[model samples]
Target: MLYYTIWTLFYSVNFHTSMVIMFSHINHKPFLGAIHDSLSLLFL
Candidate 1:
Protein backbone atom coordinates (compact mmCIF):
# COMPACT_ATOMS: atom_id res chain seq x y z
CA MET A 1 0.00 0.00 0.00
CA LEU A 2 2.80 2.39 0.77
CA TYR A 3 4.52 1.60 -2.48
CA TYR A 4 1.35 2.23 -4.42
CA THR A 5 0.76 5.54 -2.77
CA ILE A 6 4.32 6.68 -3.39
CA TRP A 7 4.18 5.67 -7.03
CA THR A 8 0.85 7.43 -7.54
CA LEU A 9 2.23 10.66 -6.15
CA PHE A 10 5.39 10.32 -8.16
CA TYR A 11 3.61 9.78 -11.45
CA SER A 12 1.10 12.51 -10.70
CA VAL A 13 3.78 15.12 -10.12
CA ASN A 14 5.97 13.91 -12.97
CA PHE A 15 3.13 13.92 -15.42
CA HIS A 16 1.94 17.29 -14.22
CA THR A 17 5.35 18.91 -14.67
CA SER A 18 5.89 17.26 -18.04
CA MET A 19 2.48 18.46 -19.17
CA VAL A 20 3.24 21.98 -18.04
CA ILE A 21 6.52 21.98 -19.89
CA MET A 22 4.90 20.57 -22.99
CA PHE A 23 2.38 23.38 -22.99
CA SER A 24 5.01 26.02 -22.42
CA HIS A 25 6.83 25.29 -25.67
CA ILE A 26 5.85 26.30 -29.22
CA ASN A 27 7.92 23.54 -30.82
CA HIS A 28 6.18 20.62 -29.10
CA LYS A 29 3.14 20.93 -31.31
CA PRO A 30 2.70 17.23 -31.95
CA PHE A 31 2.79 16.34 -28.27
CA LEU A 32 0.22 19.01 -27.53
CA GLY A 33 -1.96 17.83 -30.42
CA ALA A 34 -1.82 14.28 -29.15
CA ILE A 35 -2.80 15.41 -25.71
CA HIS A 36 -5.71 17.42 -27.11
CA ASP A 37 -6.91 14.46 -29.15
CA SER A 38 -6.71 12.15 -26.19
CA LEU A 39 -8.70 14.54 -24.04
CA SER A 40 -11.35 14.94 -26.72
CA LEU A 41 -11.66 11.20 -27.05
CA LEU A 42 -12.08 10.85 -23.32
CA PHE A 43 -14.85 13.45 -23.27
CA LEU A 44 -16.58 11.87 -26.21
Candidate 2:
Protein backbone atom coordinates (compact mmCIF):
# COMPACT_ATOMS: atom_id res chain seq x y z
CA MET A 1 0.00 0.00 0.00
CA LEU A 2 2.82 2.41 0.73
CA TYR A 3 4.46 1.58 -2.59
CA TYR A 4 1.23 2.21 -4.43
CA THR A 5 0.78 5.59 -2.80
CA ILE A 6 4.32 6.62 -3.64
CA TRP A 7 3.94 5.50 -7.25
CA THR A 8 0.70 7.44 -7.66
CA LEU A 9 2.28 10.59 -6.36
CA PHE A 10 5.27 10.23 -8.67
CA TYR A 11 3.06 9.60 -11.68
CA SER A 12 0.88 12.64 -11.00
CA VAL A 13 3.88 14.93 -10.51
CA ASN A 14 5.48 13.71 -13.74
CA PHE A 15 2.25 14.16 -15.67
CA HIS A 16 1.76 17.67 -14.34
CA THR A 17 5.32 18.69 -15.27
CA SER A 18 4.95 17.33 -18.78
CA MET A 19 1.66 19.19 -19.23
CA VAL A 20 3.25 22.44 -18.12
CA ILE A 21 6.07 21.97 -20.59
CA MET A 22 3.64 21.25 -23.39
CA PHE A 23 1.55 24.35 -22.68
CA SER A 24 4.64 26.51 -22.49
CA HIS A 25 5.70 25.17 -25.87
CA ILE A 26 2.31 25.87 -27.35
CA ASN A 27 2.32 29.36 -25.89
CA HIS A 28 5.67 30.00 -27.58
CA LYS A 29 4.49 29.09 -31.06
CA PRO A 30 5.76 31.49 -33.73
CA PHE A 31 2.86 31.06 -36.11
CA LEU A 32 -0.70 32.33 -35.85
CA GLY A 33 -2.00 29.24 -37.60
CA ALA A 34 -1.16 27.05 -34.68
CA ILE A 35 -2.71 29.43 -32.20
CA HIS A 36 -5.80 29.82 -34.32
CA ASP A 37 -6.30 26.10 -34.51
CA SER A 38 -6.10 25.70 -30.78
CA LEU A 39 -8.37 28.64 -30.12
CA SER A 40 -10.95 27.40 -32.56
CA LEU A 41 -11.19 24.11 -30.79
CA LEU A 42 -11.36 25.83 -27.44
CA PHE A 43 -14.24 28.13 -28.41
CA LEU A 44 -16.14 25.40 -30.20
Candidate 3:
Protein backbone atom coordinates (compact mmCIF):
# COMPACT_ATOMS: atom_id res chain seq x y z
CA MET A 1 0.00 0.00 0.00
CA LEU A 2 2.79 2.40 0.85
CA TYR A 3 4.58 1.55 -2.36
CA TYR A 4 1.45 2.12 -4.37
CA THR A 5 0.90 5.45 -2.71
CA ILE A 6 4.42 6.53 -3.42
CA TRP A 7 4.15 5.43 -7.01
CA THR A 8 0.90 7.28 -7.50
CA LEU A 9 2.37 10.44 -6.07
CA PHE A 10 5.43 10.16 -8.24
CA TYR A 11 3.40 9.52 -11.35
CA SER A 12 1.13 12.47 -10.70
CA VAL A 13 4.02 14.84 -10.11
CA ASN A 14 5.82 13.67 -13.20
CA PHE A 15 2.68 13.99 -15.30
CA HIS A 16 2.00 17.48 -14.04
CA THR A 17 5.54 18.64 -14.66
CA SER A 18 5.61 17.22 -18.16
CA MET A 19 2.28 18.84 -18.97
CA VAL A 20 3.50 22.22 -17.75
CA ILE A 21 6.72 21.92 -19.69
CA MET A 22 4.90 20.92 -22.86
CA PHE A 23 2.32 23.69 -22.47
CA SER A 24 5.03 26.28 -21.99
CA HIS A 25 6.97 24.97 -24.95
CA ILE A 26 3.89 25.01 -27.16
CA ASN A 27 3.03 28.56 -26.13
CA HIS A 28 6.58 29.80 -26.31
CA LYS A 29 6.53 30.78 -29.96
CA PRO A 30 3.22 32.63 -29.73
CA PHE A 31 4.37 34.32 -26.58
CA LEU A 32 7.46 35.57 -28.34
CA GLY A 33 5.34 36.82 -31.20
CA ALA A 34 3.17 38.76 -28.80
CA ILE A 35 6.20 40.39 -27.27
CA HIS A 36 7.55 41.25 -30.68
CA ASP A 37 4.26 42.81 -31.68
CA SER A 38 4.15 44.88 -28.51
CA LEU A 39 7.67 46.08 -29.06
CA SER A 40 6.91 46.98 -32.63
CA LEU A 41 3.86 48.93 -31.52
CA LEU A 42 5.95 50.77 -28.98
CA PHE A 43 8.52 51.66 -31.60
CA LEU A 44 5.86 52.70 -34.07
Off by over 4 Å in 1: 27-44
lDDT, candidates in the order shown: 0.71, 0.68, 0.67
- Using all chains and alpha carbons, the TM-scores for the candidates as numbered come to 0.56, 0.63, 0.62
Q: What's the C-alpha lDDT at position 11 in model 3?
A: 100
- In the range 1-44, model 1's lDDT, one tens digit per residue, is 99999999999888865765666464556776756754676589
User: How high is the lDDT of residue 32 in model 3?
Assistant: 53
Ordered by TM-score, highest first, the candidates read 2, 3, 1
Candidate 1 deviates by what RMSD?
A: 5.2
Q: How many backbone clashes does candidate 2 have?
A: 0
Error of 1 at 23 (Å): 0.6
lDDT of 1: 0.71
- Model 3, position 15, has a per-residue lDDT of 78
